[model samples]
Structures are given as C-alpha cells and as structure tokens.
Target: QPFTYTTAPVPALTSLTPTSGPTTGGTTVTLTGTGLATVGAVRFGATPAASFTVVSDTHITAVAPAGTGTVQVTVTTPGGTSNGISYTYSAAPTLSGVTPNQGPTSGGNTVTLTGTNLTGTTAVTFGATPATSFTVLSPTQITAVVPAGSAGPVTITVTAPGGTSALPSAYFYVSPPVLTGVAPPSGPLSGGNTVTLTGVHLIEATAVRFGTTAASGFTVVSDTQITAVVPVGAAGLADVTVNTAGGTSNPVSYTYLPAPVVTTLIPSQGPVSGGITFTLTGTNLAQTTTVLVGGTPAGFTVVSDSHIVVDALPGAPGTVNVTVTTPGGTSAPKTYTRVGSPGI
Candidate 1:
C-alpha cells in the first residue's frame, strides 16, 4: 500500500489592528489570523513591508513600507495567501499662519490657524505648552483657545498622524499696560486738547479712551509716553485709559471744564487813549488765561471765580469786543464802547 498524502490548511485573515497610517509610512500593525506561524512574507499592495516578525500561528507584527492612497495588505504562507485587508495613507499637515498672533499673557483668547492638510489634528501647542482647547473647522483651518504663558514670542506647532509641524516665532504674549499719570489732567469740555500719558508696558497701543469716548487721535511717543487728543465729553470727571495688544490699562482721572461766560463789564466804556482799567465778571473765570479787547491781548488779573480786572489797551474811538479764555474754553464777546474825548 502507498503512504497517505496530507496538505496544510490555507491561512485566513480575520482583521488588522490598525487599518491606516501616514503616506510616508513606518507604522507597526498587528495581523491576526490562522496559520501565521509559517508566514513567509507580508506584502502591502505590491510593495514589500520594511520588516516583519511572526509572533505565533495567530498573530504577526509587521512594519508597513512607504505608500500612497489606499492599498490591500496580504500575507503569504506555505499553506496559501490570506484574504486582503484595507489600509489608508494620510498626508502630513502644514501651517501657514495664525490670525491675531499676539495676545495677553493671561490667555483665554481664541485664535484661528490656516494651512493645508489639517484634518484630524491631535494636538496644538504654543512653545511647549498645549492649547487650552482646539476645534478643527476644515482641512485647512482650525480654531484654538490660547494657553497662559510668559510674556514674549513663542513657536506654535500642530500634530497629526502624518507628523508634527511648527511655525517659529509665530505667537507672542504681551504684558498689560499700566497707568501712572496724565499730564494737564484737565481740558475743555469741547475737547481738542492733547494730553501726555505716562506709564509702563505701553507699547502697541490700540486705543485711548476718555470716559466712554475714544480719543480723536493719538501717537505712541514711547513705552512710557503717549500723546492723545481728547474727545469731547460732558463737563465733569472722565476716566482715561489706554488699550494695547496685551490688555486695557488702569484708568486715570481727567476733568473736563465747561466754557467760561462773560455776563458784565465795569462801566462798559473807556477812553480811546485807553489807559483805563475795567472790571470783568463771568462764571468759570478762576482759570482765565487770556483777555482780549477788540482782538488785542490786554493785561488782566483773576480776582476770583466770578471777577477779573483788565487794563484796556489804546484803540480807535468806537465800540470794541472783549472776551476771556480759560481751560474750560473761550467766552462770548462783550461790547466795550471806546469814546473820543469831547467831539471836537
């Protein structure tokens, strides 16, 4: 009688531990099936794997070779080749820019990132610190909440299955500004006055506000100085503050005075030779800085908040206008008749 002949059963693939990897692939995947102990080769599509190791008759660990798109993974043995399993390759993500790249060191601001191939992001970082949170909006965009950090520039990075990418000097943390003083802390209620602001960490100022009104204009003179034109507001105290990329500064007090008024004038008449003195009366006159008689400046002394003595200057024999100016504003003119001695 001839000896009986036998054949080994064909290998059958049950599943793959991980079904996907990067296009530049170097992923280790676990292949589970029967008759794997005798597995002689593992092929990903038509390309052979970088390496492989048969752990047992039902399991094998293999390193996938570099690949693109999707491909079929198969195993070969003396028994037979197993059924194919699907594997996908992903592309590496990129970073192009970060909007509003600068923020306060205290963080809590949302910033948008733009780039290519950004799907399935795993992590986002500022320097070595992870973002407070992040959400992927599209394959080319992501919105992330910033994390608190020290004041200065830091690199931003994103990680995905493909790999990690970084943008050097990408984001900056700024310290909030401080306010020490405001020069000439008072101005006219009508505005249009420039004031100096002194403080620390005042760079990159974005706004200067008086009470709730924004400054007409401003210039950053230095980290400790700024010249801002006041905005009109009601007569009273207004809080002045400066804003920068870091944050809003501490508020300082500012006073806005109402315009002065001229209600009376002594005698209301003076000689054309004009060596005569006149008493002027009005509200808000304590700050009187100037007195004009018919467009000509006259010497004056502030007697009180409601009175002042002005020496009338020589002028033609006729009625002339007299006005007063103070920090509040210029006053309405008053008639001062100048008479010629005895109509000769």
Candidate 2:
C-alpha cells in the first residue's frame, strides 16, 4: 500500500490587528482566520513583509514592511493563493503645537500644527469632532480650520499614512469671557485713569478698551479681576470690554465727563454789599454746587433742582457767575453785575 499525504486548505484572513503602522517597520500585526497554517509568505500589497511566522492553523504573526497607502496581504500555498487581505501603511505624524488653541463655537478658524511626519496627513480632528477644513502644507506642518463646537476643551488628533500619531498635548477650548461691572464708572477725557474690571473667565485677558479706544495699560489679576488704564475718549458713556484667550467679555459702560458749560446768570445784578438772592444756570452742574467769586468759593445755597442762591462777601464790585464743578468737569461762570441796592 502507498502512503497518503493530506493537505490542509489555506485559511482566509478576516482581519489584521492594528491594520496600520509606520513604513519604518517594528510593528507586529496579527492575521486571523481559519487557514493560516500553510501561509508561504505574507505580502503587504505587492511588497513582501519583513518576516512572518505561522502561529497556528488560524493565526500568523508578521512584521510590517515600509510602504505608503493601502495594501492587501495574501498567503500562497500548494492549493494556490488565498483570499486577499487589506492593511494601510502610514507615517505617524506628531503634533507639537496648535496655534490659537481656542476658537468660536461656529468653528471655521484656521489653525497651524507644527511637528514631524505631518506630510500626507489624511484627517484632522478635535477630539471626536472632525475639522471643517485641513491641508497638508508640508511634511512637518499642517493647516486646518476648526469646526464649530461647544464651550470646552478637546484633544486634537492627526492621521497620516503611517498611522494616527499620539493625541496632541495641546487642546482647543471654546468660550467667551463675561464682564459684569467697571469701577470708578466716570473718568476725565484726558484718559490715564486706572479702572478695575469685574467679571468671570478673565484668565487670559489680552486687550482692554474703552469704546473704540484700546486701554493704555492692562493687567490680568485673576479670572475675575482686571486693571486697565482708560484711554482718552470723548465725553459721554461708552462700553468697556476685555479680550482674553477664551473670548471677549460683555461690554460695560464707562462714562466720560466733559468740561461743564454755563448759559446765563439769574439776578445778573447783585448788591455790592454782598448777601443777595441770585441764581446760576448752566449745564452739567455738580451735585454739590459752589458759589465762586473771583475764583474764591463764597457761601451759597442750592434752592432748586437746577438753581442756587449765593450770599456774596464784601469784595470789589464786579460781575461774575457762580461756577460748579463735578466729576463731569467744571461749569462756565455765570456773570452777576453789582447793583446799587441789595435785592432778594
């Protein structure tokens, strides 16, 4: 009787562990399925892998070979070539930094990544969120626009032909700062006044401004404290804002006071002897009105919401209006002429 030899059928590879790795080699790949016992060679696409060992009838361990793009692994045996297997060859690109780590929730902001193996990048993502736009500027650089997202921090990932690199250490955070109040609500038009800002999420304040004018100087003390110099501005109320790495704060009003203006002097004629009833009319009068005679404040009485009566001292007979001063500025003098007799 003649001895008979039995041949096992080649197995079909269902999948490959870490189906992808660098073209530089040193990656172990496990091929699985029913007929791996007779695998003559493990080929990554048309190129043969570095080495391969048959572990069992259903498993084979193989070292990845250098290549780019997708490749199929096939096993050859006495029965002929088995079904084709597929794997991707990629270069793991690292991300050193992400410029402008923060962006608007609406996304669409361009960001630059710096590191090696960045060429042939296939995809860019912010955590699980995919970027809206991306471009491979060079082997060591990438430019991608952020997609809209919620207010929070997210890890960025870059994928290339070698494989996805480690998740970037830098993160992207999206949130706008909030402003509540401004100290010393009023300031002179000359600027240079220090004002305190109170708000939330002010940790990375970059710029401060009164209206359209940027603050002369600014310091971020904490997430809720900011001191800034008021810029020269027109007389009136304008919004104040602080910009930070997170975002811009809500605007708060900063009042700018202009020099007061005087219109007329009631009882323009007064007794030279002093102690006469008179009224001064002017805009922007101070809350506490003062009667000034020759630049000297004399005794005065506030008679109404917009009126004041003064008892002048025995000074040289002359005409001068009572001037008022306030945070808004000094008011023009109201002219009062001296009369022959004292009148109420």
Candidate 3:
C-alpha cells in the first residue's frame, strides 16, 4: 500500500487590529484567526504588505504597504488564502477646539477635546506632558484630564493611530492668581490711591476687588504684578482678590484707614488755661497722633474713631485754631477763644 500525505488546513482571517492607520502607511496590524502560523504572505487588497511575521497559529503582525482609502486585508499560507478583513487608511487628524483651555498647574480638570479624525486617540498632551487620562468618545471628541504643569501658556494636542494634531491649539496651565502681598496694604477709606499687588500668574487680570468694592483703573503689569487704583471701602480690613480666566486668587488683606474729621470741640472758647481737659468730637479719630491748639502739641487720648480727649496747651490768644491728627491725616481746625485777664 502507498502512504498518503495530507496538506495543512486553510487559514481563516477573523480580524485585523487596529483597523485603521494613516494613508502614508507603516502601521503594524495584528492579524488574528486560525492557521496563521505559516502565513507566507499578507495582502491589503491586491497589494502585498511590506512585510509580515507569523507569531502563532492564530496571530500575524503585518506591516501595511503604502495605500489609500479602505481595503480588504488577507493572509495566505500553504493551505490556502484566508478570508479578508477591512483596513482603513485615515487622513491626518485635525483639531477644532478645546474646552476650558485654562486649568490649574496641578492639572486635574476634565477637558473636552474636539477635533476631526479623533477616533482611536491614543494620547492627549499639554506641552510635552501627556494627559493624566483620556477617553475617546467619538471620531470628533475625547475627554481628558489635564496633566500637572507649570504656569502659563502651553499647546495642547491629540494623537491617534493616524497622526497628531498641530500647534497653536491653545492650552494653559495656570497657578490661579496669587496675592502674596499688596504694596501699601493700607489706604485711605475714601480710596483713590495707586496700589501695587504682588504675586504669581496675575496676567490678564479681569477684575480686582477690595472687599466687595471693585477697583478702578486696574492694570496687569506682568505675570506676577498688577497696579490698581483702590476703591472706597468701609474702615476695616478688606479682602483683596484678583480674577482671571484661569481662576480667582486667594485673598490678601487691605485695611482702609478712615480719615479724621473734626465735628466739635467741647469748650471751643476755653480760657487760655493750659491744664483744662477738652473733649473732642469727630469722625474717625481713634488713631489721633496729635492735638494742636494754635501750633502747640497738646497731650491727647483717643477714645474712639469718633472721639478724643486732649489737655489744652497754654497759648497767647484771641482766637486759636485746634485740630486733631490721625494716621489718615489731620482734621480741619475749630476755633478756641481765650479771654485776657482784667488789668488791675
């Protein structure tokens, strides 16, 4: 009897992954199915793949030949040619927009990536840093977490099996405006003083606030500085903040110093006696540094922002001007009349 030899079974190609790549080709596709061990050749439509390696009876890695559009990919072994699966030649990716282009330096905000040919996006990056994570929602959208970064402008991009998006696609990593301190942190309650704010990431500040009052004529001096005309606020510690597209900064305190205003002087016509205690009534007198009766500095005590007590100073007088001074500056004087003693 003569011995009979049986040929190997024909291969059956079930899938090709990643199913798509750039038209320039050079994509390595994993071909999976039965009887792949002896894959002698791989064909994308009628064109042969540049190269192919059989990895197992059910796997082959084939380097795609340069091509365009979609085509059927197949494998052939000694047994026979396998069934065909589709492979797409994709166009270069394009970016349309990026949501919330600005985020914190620590980078944790969920940003939406919008563009064309974004399906199968393998990576999203800010500058050279990859996103924390990302999910492809469709051919035109992906959701990604911004990666940690230093402050200021950075370009953001997306990458797919096809290609990476291009630059000027704006992205910013900001350190929300910091208010380390303000020059001249205390100002007159009536405002109108130029104050310099010092900190980081102060570029393009949209608004400056002193407590609840908005600053006027505010200028962003640089990435870390701003100059603003202070706004009137109640006499107290006011919280100052800067706002930008990135975010609002932590507040720094500014104290509004109320200017003293003299309203009355008890015994406005006191005798020239140098030891008489005089009660002073005024607005914002608490910080009274001096009480002057006709150019004489008298001993004084501040009772409150609106009251003070001072001992009169001896003065040669018909009528003398009395005034009070505080950190906010001096008050207008009230007249004190002195009567000369009757001559003997």
Clash counts for all predictions: 0, 6, 2
Off by over 4 Å in 2: 1-20, 23-41, 45-75, 79-89, 102-108, 147-154, 167-169, 172-174, 188-192, 234-236, 267-277, 286-322, 333-344
lDDT of each: 0.92, 0.77, 0.85
Tell me the lDDT of model 2 at 124. 90
lDDT of 1 by residue, 230-274 (tens): 998998899999999899999999999999899999979979998
Q: Between prediction 1 and prediction 2, which has the larger lDDT? A: 1
Best by lDDT: 1
Colliding pairs, model 2: 11-35, 90-161, 90-162, 91-161, 91-162, 321-334
| Span of 10 residues, lowest total lDDT, candidate 3 | 267-276
The global Cα lDDT (0 to 1) of model 2 is 0.77
lDDT (Cα, tens digit) per residue for candidate 3, span 1-344: 99989898999988888999888889899998999888888999999999988889988999998888899998888999988899998887888888888887878889887889888788888898998999999998888898889877888878887878855748877777788999877768778889999998788688999987899779988988999999878878999999886678999998888778988888776665667877889788876778888888888888887788888777676888888876566788898887666678
Alpha carbon deviation, residue 18, candidate 1 (Å): 4.4
